[model samples]
Target chain A: MSRAWAVSVAMMVAALPAWAQDVGVVSTEQFESPRSGGIIVRVGGYKPLLDDEKALNGKTPFKDTFGDSSLLLVELELQRYFYQGIGTAGVGVSAGYGEKYAAAKLESGVDAAEQTALKVVPLGLNLFYKFDYAAFEWGIPLVPYGKLGLIYSPWWVTKGTDDEVVDGIPAKGGKWGWGATGGVSFLLDVLQPRFARDFDSGLGINHSYLFAEYTYSDVDNFGKPGFVLSSRRWMFGLALDY
Target chain B: MRLTFAVLLLFASTALGQTAPVVNFAVPGASQGTEIVVSKATCGDTRTVTWSRTGTLPCSSLVFWLSSDSNCSGDPGDGDLVLDSEEVPQNNTTTLSGTLELKMSDALAATPNLSCDTQATNKSYRVCASTKKQDSLLACDDTASGVGTPTIVFTLDPVAPLAPAVPTVTGLDSALSVSVTVPGDTSQMKVQVVELVQSGDDGGTPTAGAEKVSKVQTTDNTVFRMEGLENGKLYGVFAYAIDKAGNQSDPSTLATGEPIPSNGFYAAYREAGGQETGGCGAGGGGLALGAVVAALGFWMMSRRKLS
Candidate 1:
């Protein structure tokens, strides 16, 4: 309909663009239909800077006053595609688990620090789309494309180390947020000797990709949504399509 | 006779050229305040003396004192030597070393318990001589009236407490049990745990989710929690042990664990603290070190400790 509307649609696809662009294969093997769909999964994590977590609120039961804890992230994306031959879109859903943690503070049990840990999870649904430009005619042998997705990360609840206290602080979980993401995707074939001739003859194809995205979340520290949490990152992953 | 003469000479030198005793104090941080340790507590061989006009205040310029109590107390011995009423000589740091051995008839006539050894709270005391007896006024900050009565510092018997050997972290997530064995003389020791994480090696561009392992102490073992880990993501765990007499050892080696890392921590805690009963399902794992690091070994079995 419109350029903005189109971009919004592209961001709703759930395929790991990096994977598809990096290792996946194209459907040059005479497909039954001009469409494709598959699954994408990733397990990874990151650490937040001291400055960022301090922004969460007052104090926490975490043993570390400094920024030392780390986060583990696991995600699942179910992707389905249509309209192939360089031009197509994919739709998918995702889910996963993760946590944050720190070690004990003091040596003695009396004034010692406790090893605090936090977990993050995406408890919501997702949708997305992508537009791939054919790699045939142009000198550019790699296929290039763009993507957009809408992620509804539901309220994340925490568990374990419940009775732990850091300077009289208890634990707290967070609310859900609507995340919007958009980025680029590419396809690169693996240099397997057996597939070389077939790959050059256009008989076989592989998928690989790189994508950058921005995610915004909501914060209800003061009992109301007053802050928006945001994270931006570039990821590399692969997905197969036929 | 010559040998006796030589021994005498050595003794005389030792007596005449004594070294100034070192004053040691503990600054527990600005929030904690300073703990002063006076040296050579006994006064020199003088009976009575006056404070010099020239010693700089370590913290502030204001100074005050009681004829008796060297302690920072508002109360002191009943001695109205009347401030500058009697100006003792200066250049007499030696004469000023101990308590002013002056008799106080007027002091006893007034406040009976006016000892110079009284101690006060949060106040610094110093002795100074001025032309006017009243000129020997106490100064608390720039305000002369704020100095509640006078205060002093007195020497106390030194009782040194021996330090205990350090302890170590014994376990992670799932009842981290920590065992600490100190010498018979060791006093109260404390223990704690904290989780940390760092990037793996970059030399070979290692894959994400790789873990970094730290040290642990375990003759037998010392454990803290059982299965209290962050899921999926890697972790760095640590511990510490301290003795009762305030002897603290450095933190112990760091262990690693991932609790339900597939799911996040806050989410799980919320579920646990709220709806789900110990929803931190038993699917977590730990990176155990060795038997020595009892705390480190628990990394393998991360079953839910809550439920």
Candidate 2:
């Protein structure tokens, strides 16, 4: 009777794999969604290198007035993947805004009643490459990307309600430059594979990721001796592929 | 045939028995139940009172008058002031029209018995009109029947509102910000700025210079910014509350501020020998770049759809 009970237990153990399979517990590699383009929403700290000019003679006017604080820059970038085989390559366009406000300084070096503000609108066009192949095939869930871009930043200074004018020149202009960015994204689908598949089927979103990037930009009109709007900053944001 | 003749005879008697004409009074450019503001600025302005009659009753004239009573019911020998007597000529037309021009000063002068010295107070009067038949005014005794009379209230506010509190002045670069606590009865506030000329002698008080700038705020906002001032100079600031009648109150206690030079970011950049001139850099280049990017995106989207 003990030998018969051992046989019954052995048969039940043999059918366990088949039972799990029948109950829809399948691997994520089976279901795949078509991939196209991606959208990224990012924010970063940006402070233009205004004191780097040689004529300033070691005087940090920007730091003296606004102090050593970085403005919070929020950016939105859109990329369309034209080639998407081993990796994805696309041209992206991004726009961002940042501003800093501080109490204006008087001629006596004291704080004034009115506020002075420095505002910037940064626009960029870039060609990007994302090595997302391992994420889809090997399920490594980490995608590394690189971007080379051209940037044009329009900046303005305001005192009170009007544009600040000094020596008959209005304080508003744009600077042109170039930048390079490198970032790594972590796939969110690996944490919740079933919900990720449902999201794909329901909202047409193929994948989602959280990413952080570092950018090195030289935005002084190709170093033509002007206001150096260049900066090196790190940005963190979410990325969505559809 | 006898019944038809009797009906015609009754209609003819009813038409002939109508002795008084129906009158309606309207003030041009003024809506119903709105108070008209009379001030020193508009003292000589005239408001036309139009009356229209709709009856062929052979009325001699239309008598128009102003009375403090809402019904215009008091005896004419008392406070009732006759404005105009427009003669109605005998004509074939059933509708008769007349206009009475009421000058604001004349209206105020006619009602001397009423108080006009209070701040923002309404002095009301009824614009009454009656059709005259052989020098006898019709419907003048019937106060209960409110048919042809329209009441118009005149806000004769000749007194100024209470002065505001002393202004709190802040010095800025080539400007001064002044704020005051407005009185409850104030409708508007005015801020006046004057530059102060300091005496060359030591410890002498600064004398007031010519008025530099004045700004009137018509909103409930009590803050004013006097701009275009010279830097490194002292200035006096004063605030006054104004009533709805355009009467300005006495100036508040004197407050002073000193404008100073303020350095902004652009100024700092220029001081650092930045070569970039402040303007649109490379005109139209930014716009062209945006257009190219947008076109490329649309083309890529269409290609995806085709595939």
Candidate 3:
């Protein structure tokens, strides 16, 4: 019986190597989906420089009504990459909405029973470049980007329920200008590479990132003198590449 | 075993025959226990009551009555009013059904002693129904072998709610904002705006014109905006509250305001010689730009698929 037990142990030990080979437990190769475009959802504080118009001189009508607080702007941007060799180059379009409301004031300097609101819809078309080669090839997880864009902002002011009209001039207009933005994005795939590979294979999502950016915009109808919609703000949000 | 089965069958038959008839009542088209609110607006309406019964007891009639008592017990007292009687065919039917109409005017006339002036102290009555033998008259009494009586209540309300406080009026460009502090029991408020016509005589008070510009009603106590008035024109504002019973209160104290030209941010910019023509043209330009970008994105997506 002891001889039979020795033979059985030897046979089990010999099958272990074949079982390990079948499992194939150690592999670092990744199969990724094709990448073409990305979408970003961002929110930030935006305060238009309405009082900075040279035509306004010293009167701050926007400040007097809406105070110094900034409006919360929510924006969504869609990008399509045209080149993706060493770095990625793309054209992006963004749309955003922001509004501010306060109690309207009479000429007597007292708060009225009605509210006055300023609403704006900001639109943008941008050419952007992102340096993401290090994140993909060198195992680094940070991507830096830059954007130069044209901005068109439509603004309106309302007192009570109707648009304000002062001396036959209605309180609504649009401004056009240009802007430049710079941002840094942190890649989220490095923390769980296996899960990232699964995500790419199953959902066709190649990468995900959390990013923060600063924009310097001048949107006063290309300096023709109307409602100065220029603004400098910072935004933070998520980005998904598919 | 056969003898035991026969005894059990006889006992079950006796119990079924002795059971009281189960009676249920409802307002026709309404749920089982929905209360009928009788206000001045609905005082002339007729509400039909439907009753159904189920039992082995031999019943020949179904009678419905109204009582101020919650339990709907006892014979017809001074406070108890018999509504109507529905006669069923005396064929020993186990199930019976009928309907009776209760006129709100008659119910109100029945209570000449109680004041139905206000909803705060409103009067309520319960509807009851019972199945009885051919000659029996009283319903909802101890001697009746009927059970499962209805508990639907009818309330009478007639008076208007208290007037709201005086309104505070503010003037804007072509608009008037009216704010009223609503009373506790009020369910809604209405704001009325009228253009004030100035008198030609010197130092004469302006009179409100006959034509009203706007009449707005809201359930919330927030400020009401009356729009579409001429700028630089004086206007009169009035507010009133209404209760849930559809009764309107008296008009509040008059408040006056003048719609003047106010400068907003864009208006100020234009007044300062900022040359931006605002309207649908500028918005259309933005939309055109967005369409171009979207078209480019779709083209790129299709190109990638082709490759």
Candidate 2 residue B56 Cα shift, in angstroms, is: 24
Whichever of 2 and 3 has more DockQ, that candidate is 2
lDDT of model 2, residue B231: 79
Q: How close to the true structure is residue A1 of candidate 3, measured as C-alpha lDDT?
A: 100
Give the range of the ten consecutive residues with the poorest summed lDDT in model 2 chain A.
A25-34
Model 3, span A75-178: residue lDDT tens: 98888888998989998888899999887665566676567788988888999999999998888999999999988887888876778776676777677789
Note the DockQ of each predicted structure: 0.03, 0.34, 0.31
Query: Could you give the fnat of all candidates in order?
Result: 0.07, 0.64, 0.31
Worst 10 residues of 1 chain A by lDDT: A219-228
| lDDT by residue for model 1 (A1-242), tens | 69988887677554467657767775543322222454455554433321234334543323233244445566656555544555566555556566555443332322223444544555333355555554333424344444443332222223234544322334333333444555554444433423533543453223434333434333222222222223443333454443
- Interface RMSD of candidate 3? 3.5
* Residue lDDT tens for model 2, A122-182: 8889999999999988889999999999888888889888888888998888888899999
Taking the tens digit of each residue's C-alpha lDDT, what string does model 2 give over B169-239? Answer: 88777788888888865778999998777788795887667788999997478778888988777888889
**Residue A157, model 3, lDDT:** 86
Clashing pairs in 3: none
Alpha carbon lDDT at B3, candidate 1: 100
lDDT of 1 by residue, B1-307 (tens): 9999998888767544432211122222222122222211221222233232323222222222333333332323343234433323422334222223322222223345533233221222233222111122222233222122222222221222233334343333333444445433223333433444334655442222332322333323443343444434444443434332233455444444443322123322222232222211222111111121233123212322211
By DockQ, the better pick of 1 and 3 is 3
lDDT of each: 0.36, 0.75, 0.73
Winner by TM-score:
3
